[model samples]
Target chain A: MNFQPYRSPSTGRPVRAVLFDTFGTVVDWRTGVAREVAAFAAAHGHTLDADAFADHWRALYQPAMDAIRSGQRGFTKLDTLHRENLDAALRHHGINPDQFSRETLEELNKSWHRLPPWPDSVEGLAAIRRHYIVGPLSNGNTSLLLDMARDAGLPWDVIIGSDMTGTYKPLPQAYLRTAEFLDLEPGEVMLAAAHNSDLQAAREAGLATAFVARPTEHGPGQAVDLAPEGDWNLVASSIPGLADRLGA
Target chain B: MNFQPYRSPSTGRPVRAVLFDTFGTVVDWRTGVAREVAAFAAAHGHTLDADAFADHWRALYQPAMDAIRSGQRGFTKLDTLHRENLDAALRHHGINPDQFSRETLEELNKSWHRLPPWPDSVEGLAAIRRHYIVGPLSNGNTSLLLDMARDAGLPWDVIIGSDMTGTYKPLPQAYLRTAEFLDLEPGEVMLAAAHNSDLQAAREAGLATAFVARPTEHGPGQAVDLAPEGDWNLVASSIPGLADRLGA
Candidate 1:
């Protein structure tokens, strides 16, 4: 069996395009959004379910992203998806329908863009960016990804969000689409992710995988993808370290 | 007459997306490609008419881009467009058909990808990237743009080349389609360039215009677009200064 390795020719290194798993890789949503939710609740003088709401919102991600992938629904941006989730959250909180204006809903939806970058994220991406073209192959739609980039000062060479592919990550189509968008073969792109499952999937599609452990991606004590499993092409402790290892 | 200002919120400081005029704005196609043509001819031990070929090939751009835009031809990428031009040039140059293989011709077509970046391009873009979602909205196809970005180290957040929009710049739909593809309102995107005609058309169509004077865009002794002609939002001596003025 011939195994195809995704490597860059510049340094005889594996991978040219480092496609990131955005939600948990670059930014921490749990704590960031939880605090905002709590504060928004507090400002409203209401005791509401912040954690549950956050979990509900995150839970809807796949199903919503799947709608497009399955061809059940037309393409929709993440902002609209977040809006759909927020409207239900508001209803669950028993808030009066007329209490909040469309402006309020818009601002709340923007919270996703405000999530704080991981301690190593900004510095890490900057370092990787010097040598390789780093972009997010995220489930986040283009608008959401673009907004997040603006809010967090993420210096991405391109935005390979799901909106472009009309499919979510873990699908070979999604990975292939990123490579195609970058005008590279699948073997030329490396999926630099914090999740083992994402790596496993990209590997199956012949994309090189680099694991940057985000032990706290799901929050402390979560322990998901705490280590690389199977045979990943490269593994690094952090994004900057990954950059160094990749000759960035 | 009240002049409507061009600004896109998707890009906060100015517009979310700033479309560029490719031929002269992003790449110095005439000089760049002519230089490559000269080198290729020398390597092949043939007297290639570099200047004649460059002019003849460029003359095919508008009709080709327009054909796609007008649906006279289905969406053909710039690679295909360039290859078609090469075929025509090869016939005109009376080059022997057996002299080059199909793959060789394809590789030669990629000469456009290696176009040299203008002196201030990288730094100016680095500065501009601080604020805008920089990408070329040229008649060049996505794959061509992608390779160009990688080869020249151009930092583009998206590659809205001709193939994606099914048209070329200077066409209202090309600029309009770019904003729509990014899911941005026309008012939220800016068309930044050195061409007055491009800026004028963009301004007319509700896109903000930023003019970065490329005094030698038409090569030395060029007298066009010496200064801002249509009251563009910002006029600067260089791309970096444009970045600074935009406070990117």
Candidate 2:
């Protein structure tokens, strides 16, 4: 076992915590959500593009967070936002929302809470955890993240939810406050993410950045986040590959 | 394995989170700190009673937290308060504060972060964690709790530090805010603590409470907290006993 510290390229100092972007970086949200949505559709006697339905729901994520980031709305849990987005996605698919009971809607909304992790995520995080504090630095709420961790077998040392920070990704405080909560300087906390924009924002917040690519996060023709668009501190094809790069 | 949900005695609702008090509850702070203090004293050529010194340091804990609970002081990390208290304890022992270097004082303050868990803490927490969310809901800061969890092998699903809540224990917000963080109803969160005052505060805040006795926490002749002092939801002689009662 290598006992040497993992140094942050940004500060030339040891990285104490390695936080992750959960949705696409650590978990295969597209596949997980689509599977749940397909099951929901089958049970409800509806036939539609479940994968596209998942995409439609995810497409609303940024705008809802942008509302809070722009100060147009107070901080809300991602669970609540997901519920609202679910309604919009149902309407977009020409499905009558009134047919669904509140309990059913809530269970569907929690599809995010039980998303399956990427094949490499669990082992990669375990390896990294042996060397540093490891956890999700996602926009998911604490409860949502906790449920996902329990369901997906993600061994997190801590959970930093958007509700805990009262902000979402791409916002500076989303990265900075999480670092402050861990009593670490931003540079000593590395953000291992799959999105270039997320990594860019984290870097701007003075956090060390690593880009882990999920080429199929948006399915076969996924165009965005296909490569490292910025000069991230590290880049890898998979989380375990990133772990290897960190010598974890 | 038991699949039945653990119901909170307060509201007869299923409890989802089981948070703990760290010092003297999960970990043996008196013995742990005394060991470190004894080693420090020996290395520095001092002949102080180490256990007494640990008592002196711990005796200042509540008063320091009370200052914050009363709003006489703004939110401060327990680490900072511990450092301040260390200075007073040093002076009380007739030791020159200037004799210790900043590095030495910092290392001494971190003794709290390396506390050894009580015999049942690790296994009991593991058992309880398999059934419910488990973590520290202590006056210690997040980094302190994280370090202690790592060192003590306390299997936690989340960590609710005083800094995370921005208030010390016994404050209404301290208990309420932690519940809010987990998106759990107050009754859905149970606080298992060694201190009656903490359990009382949690109960008043509408959280279910459990008392685990640590009769020797303050050493022989420890009179306080030897038995359950309030109408706690559960009472046990050890953490494993508490886990057994919860059917975990």
Candidate 3:
């Protein structure tokens, strides 16, 4: 595939770092979560539509974060949010919350930390890291990101997440604070995400933006975010494609 | 040389993460700084005792941090502190600040970010990382630690430093906050350092501690911290020695 390097028309400063959106961009969370949930359900002699359970649990992610982002609740780690959402999802699915031991439930909640990286994530990140600082700028808390990195062998130069900034994606504070913490101008950091909305927010925060399509991020027949929504600085189909375009 | 693992007498919990003290424990900052300063002076046709200059600059480190730790000043990144100390050192050494351009001075101040790790730092960290998450919990800021890790090829699974906590070491907050952020009990995390004072503070904070003696951390003929002053959970002569004792 032919790849074209991106240049910021506004500042033209070279990109020094690539801050990624973690979930669908780097890891196949939907598949990973569904697999773990199915295994857990089988072990506990419970019948569950694991795929639906995974989707339902993820559907609660944004609302949980919205509570903190909208100031309705104080900042809480994504791990806490996941546990609460997991319990609610279990209850909603007609599974008695008491059916699983506390330790089993806690282990299941950490499914996020056990996610495997997308096929191209590790190699592409290694390529990018040779030329630029690369890390996740995601809603996952510091521990979550760190655990995922270690589990998946993701070579992140740094880890930046909403937990550090106490705000969720699309919030100006998240993008701005990430760049500030890295001691880089927003223009010097590019947000490479599978979600157009995340790139849009990053662009508004003065960061360079790239869109990498994850056509089946929500599994087969997934709709939305399959194409770039705006005139992103770079658009690619995979992380390696992004790496090539970035000359990494 | 023979090595023995030291077990914690207090909690006896297995270690999950090893937080390092970066400057003296991981990197030879004194030799690195002196070498860079000497090179810069020769390039600028200046004559100076680089060894004494490095020592004098380091001598100001504790007092500068003390100001912030004592609440006399707001939290400041170590980069800022290093730059301020660099200017003071330059002036004190009878060099006109104008002799070098702003960029030159700025580059020189970043010598800290380019310090060479001790011979065992890379290998030892890699070994420890196999069994436990290993990262620096130091006074250095995030960017500084990131740069040094990249330059020195340190395979840190995570990076946690005073920048994240807005406090310096020997303070309970630094150790406590790091554990809180990692979502681990203090007893589950070990603070590995070359200074007994740091290990003492970690112990008091209810965290496990390991003392790795950097006998020449302050350069040859240095006094104090040459031996373990307290019954730290583990004590070793080098990072690799520490790793061996920890069974990593």
Model 1: per-residue Cα lDDT over A1-248, one tens digit each: 24333464422445667878888888888777777888877887878778766767777777877787777888787778888877777777686646878887788778897888888888989977766778898888776787788788787777766766767777788898778767777777888888888888888877878888888766667756888886787788888888777776
Per-model TM-score on C-alpha atoms: 0.85, 0.98, 0.96
Q: Rank the candidates by DockQ, best first.
A: 2, 3, 1
Complex DockQ per candidate: 0.49, 0.88, 0.74
Per-residue C-alpha lDDT of model 3 across residues A33-90, encoded as one tens digit per residue: 9999999889888898998999999999999989888999999889999999999999
Residues B1-248 of candidate 1 have per-residue lDDT tens digits of 34223344423343666666666777777788788888878878889778777777777766777787777887777788888888888778887646788987887788888888888887888777656677887777776777788788787777776655656667788888778767777877877788888888787777887888877765677787898887778788777877776666
**In candidate 3, what are the lDDT values of residues B1-248, reduced to their tens digit?**
34333346776777788989999999999999999999998998889999899999998899999999999999999999999999899999998887778899999999999999998999999988888889998999999999999999999887876778879988999999889888888998999999888889999999898999888878889898989999888888888888888887
Candidate 2 iRMS, in Å? Answer: 0.8
Question: Which segments of model 2 are wrong by more than 4 Å?
Answer: none
User: Residue by residue across A25-129, what tens digits does model 2's lDDT show?
Assistant: 999999999999999999989999999999999999999888999999999889999999999999999998888899999999999999999998999999899
Q: What is the lDDT of residue B82 in candidate 3?
A: 93
Error of 1 at A30 (Å): 1.5
The best candidate by TM-score is 2
DockQ of candidate 3 against the true complex: 0.74
